[model samples]
Target: MNELTPDVFDALIGQDFVVTNDDGAKITMSLTAVSRFETGAPATDIDGNPLRAVGFQLTLRGPAQPLLATQAYPVDIPGIGVHHLLMSAFEAGRTAVNYDIVFA
Candidate 1:
């Protein structure tokens, strides 16, 4: 798999991604937005070298029920392959739930 960068997902907005739950159920989520921002302080790599100061957040919309706990989930992105991503439920309404995947 390639790096999970904003560029990798920029073209994916409005597309659908399938997230596999812990119970092995597949939840369909739409890629709603890809928000980018400055990290303020420079981030470091494992070797302690300075990395990019920019970061991004992925917003997805899915069903409201079966509220998913904040954790890593296997998500299948069209043409990007499956990847394990940490996601948290950001909001929930009567019919939909929003999840966020932050890369910082």
Candidate 2:
């Protein structure tokens, strides 16, 4: 399957997705921010070598239900297709939480 690029994923903002938690609870998450604040610096390796790295930052906001998870999981978006990614929480509130989805 062709995976989505950061630009394509960013265009999918305001979309909703579903994921099953470890406890078997299905939750709904809305795509809030396609990416977090980025400086646009060229990605490089530890040795400062330029690398052709492409990544998407998906911010999922869901209800106060059990957290979606901070690990690799599969999420399905209506027309985008299913993607297995590592979703990590960066900031959260009483109602919703921000997740940084690793689109590798």
How would you encode candidate 1's per-residue C-alpha lDDT over 1-104 as one tens digit per residue?
32778998998999999999999999999999999999886577788977768889999999997789999999998897899999999899999999999887
Cα RMSD to the true fold for all candidates: 1.9, 4.2
lDDT of each: 0.90, 0.71
lDDT of 2: 0.71
Query: Please, what's the RMSD in Å of model 2?
Result: 4.2
TM-score to native of every candidate shown: 0.88, 0.71
lDDT of 2 by residue, 1-104 (tens): 33565667677778888877777667788888765344455787689975445545678887765766578777887677677778887887898877777543
